[model samples]
Target chain A: MRGGSWRQSSLTGIGVLFGVTLAGLLLLPFFALAISTPASDLLEGATHPLFASALLLSLRTTLTSLSITVVLGTPLAWWLASSSSKTARVIEVLVGLPIVIPPAVVGVALLQTFGREGLLGPALGSVGIALPFTEISVVLAQIVVSAPFFVKAGASAFREVRPDMLIVARTLGASPPVAFFRVALPIALPGLLVGASLAWARALGEFGATLLFAGNMPGRTQTMPLAIFYALESDVRLAIVFSLVLAAVGMLLLVALRFLPALRNFMRGGNA
Target chain B: MTSWQVIVRARRGELDLDVTFEGDEQPIALVGPNGSGKTSVLRAIAGVLDLRDARITVGDTVLEDTSAGVRVPIEERRIGYVPQGFGLFPHLTVLENVEFGLSTGKNPLQSEERSRRALQMLSELNCASLSERSVKHLSGGEKQRIALARSLVLEPAFLLLDEPLAALDATLRRTLRQFLAERLRLFQGPSITVTHDVRDVAALGAQIVALENGRIVQQGPLSLIQQSPATEFLAEFVGAD
Candidate 1:
């Protein structure tokens, strides 16, 4: 009995040790950041004009990127879900490639493809269109880098939809478009929203690609992350403030997403 | 009076289905074993399944005739189908699911009127208490009732149910079979039910069309199919003792 108790105690000790180490690795940096930065200084730095502009720019660009992602991604996702052709698989793999590629490389590749001297550059230049180092370029960069997230989530959600539901709708006198919008879209909304939120967060925090493609310009193209980088070069307090604000917004979005009835149903393991 | 005759031919992998049937006053039950093309027959009649050579006519309407190169879209077929799983829209409330077909159709009923109609349908199915409840919250039996109400509220020319009680427990299946028989009797239109359960044929009091290997082996009154059972497969299907 004593030996069994000793072994049990040792097992308990091992469990606690593993749990603590895992928790520390996962949470230590966040705790350190919270501890290191004083709330008062963070607030003061956040109110600075340049930081304010960056925050606004980040919100605007990320929202625009999100809108574009939803519009284009939803149909593509739906198509991918319904089609079993080899071409659809190829397109799915192509869309997923962005997620695995390093963000910095994605940035460089975007520049090489859409830059002034790149492919389609001559045609675009002839039309007097310039993409690099502009605010629009920032939006474009965010879209290209963030859209795959929305597409992937939206496709999975669409795939989860029962084909019989759509067939029932059609037999009940619903046109294809009406059935898709009324039945499929509502069912897939939670996943689509989650995808949008993820893409928005990624776009909001975008630094490497934005810097490479859009070029950090204050009040023009400088997003919150870019501002944080610039502020850290001069004022550390402002960087902390920007980081806090971004974190707060992200948290708020997550809370809002959780409140959606569709998402809530999904979380509770209810099928759509 | 809406009357229909349908002939469909299709090859799904190794299974080739070539079948023909007609309907008038009687409610038909396509009784068959698994993969015997019962659901495919209903799907073809509903215009949900694409067939290489198919001809379908409902009253004066020529819905589909591949030989004549005419095929009606599913939305235009004016047929109601309840798939095997009941396929309730989990995101919508019971009332909303019933109202869906009416709201999106060519000649859409007004929302208020549609709600009233839906409520009446729920009442018919003894599920009026579940109107405001989300479909996801409904029990399996309640969901099936709502799916039936949703399909029936449209008052289509014909109705199709694929394995209507296949998802229910034995007790629920018996209860629902009785309820469905009563409802089908009052429908005032041709109806087709696909099921493997011989008990459903008796309970629903439907004409039995037994199928084996995608071909109609025998079809007549339920008693005839049960008593004679043209093929050995039909005898096995009827669970001959």
Candidate 2:
């Protein structure tokens, strides 16, 4: 027993050592990014035209993609959460494919589907529509890659809502949609918000797909990550500043995710 | 008093349940071991579970009749169901949870009217103090009462309770069972209650319908079932020789 206790203590010690090492490795870059530059450099970067256009474009495209993801992914997530069928399982796998597929491959696939000589080429040409090297393509790429995160998280969130609650809601005279809006949605709100935040973060940092599908235009389709890439070729300091700004935004989202539960409780009349 | 009849022929996974029972005013206690499909029976009656073949009627109103091609949607069933552990809406306050039904359905009341009715129902269930409180902060017994109020406010033709006191501690279970008995009396509607404890059956003064392997093995007054229990589960339940 004494030897076992000593072994257990050593195991715990080793676990903590490895955990701290990994955390340090992950956090050191961010800490360096903050302390390496004076605040004035960050301010200068924020005021730059490249920073302004990239920030605005990133915000616009990511918001649009996130909205579309929520609108389309929610029902699909709910269906997946409630269903126990083979088809739902297959579709869930299909939805998850983009998350693991390389972003450049996704860009190529998008090009093939919506490009000038692609599958929908003639149909789109008839309507006088072209999608390559556009802001809309950037939004499309973000949606394809980021929506799966929301759907995966959203489905699990909706599943956490007990089926019995919906049944009771129905018995209480709430229609199917009413029950969904009143009970399921509110119960799953915090989780859905977390998922949306993750998807938005992914969309904000999207690079390879945006680079291929939406060319590196200065103000039109150039998002923040693309701007950072372009800036890095000639101006490393500017790239660092852009990285710092993106890191700050991402950190804000992370902090918001941490407080979502408290916010939900507050909105529900401070019940918690 | 509405006379309620339930005929459930449902197969879910391995459980092939076929049960038929009827009651009026008196609360029917469905005592069965775990995995006996008692809750499934209640769900079938409540129109939440689709049955292979079933007929549920309260008085002359047919809630479901598969052969007749008449199956009412869950919201239109008007069979108040308080599922096991009392499935309260966690996002709503007690009053809002109770007011949910009143805010919807074919005849939705005004907001003031909804609150009034919800408060009245809460008062009837002796839970008026908890109206503004969040359902998340409610104790088990309080949740049971609030759930009852939420369902009873609608005044459905029948009430189906699935182990209404199953989630409470033993000491609280006794008190809540007594409370539930009184509430059932006041309700005066044909109701079915699923339970595992014989004490719950006696406390509620409910007629017993003992189930085994998803089928009704024996059913009668508790006194009668005690005299001649069919299955070993029923024998153990009634403490029969």
> Candidate 1 lDDT, tens digit per residue, B82-113?
99889998778889899988887668999899
| Prediction 1 global C-alpha lDDT | 0.86
Q: Model 2 over residues A72-174: C-alpha lDDT tens digits?
A: 9999999999999999999999999999999999999998999988899679989998888988999999999999999999999999899999999888888
**Model 2 segments more than 4 A misplaced:** A1-20, A38-44
- Candidate 1 — which pairs collide? none
| CAPRI-style class, candidate 1 | medium
- In CAPRI terms, model 2 is classed as medium
Worst 10 residues of 2 chain A by lDDT: A263-272
Looking at model 2, residue B86 earns an lDDT score of 90
At residue B34, candidate 2 shows an lDDT of: 92
For lDDT, the strongest prediction is 2
Error of 2 at A139 (Å): 0.6
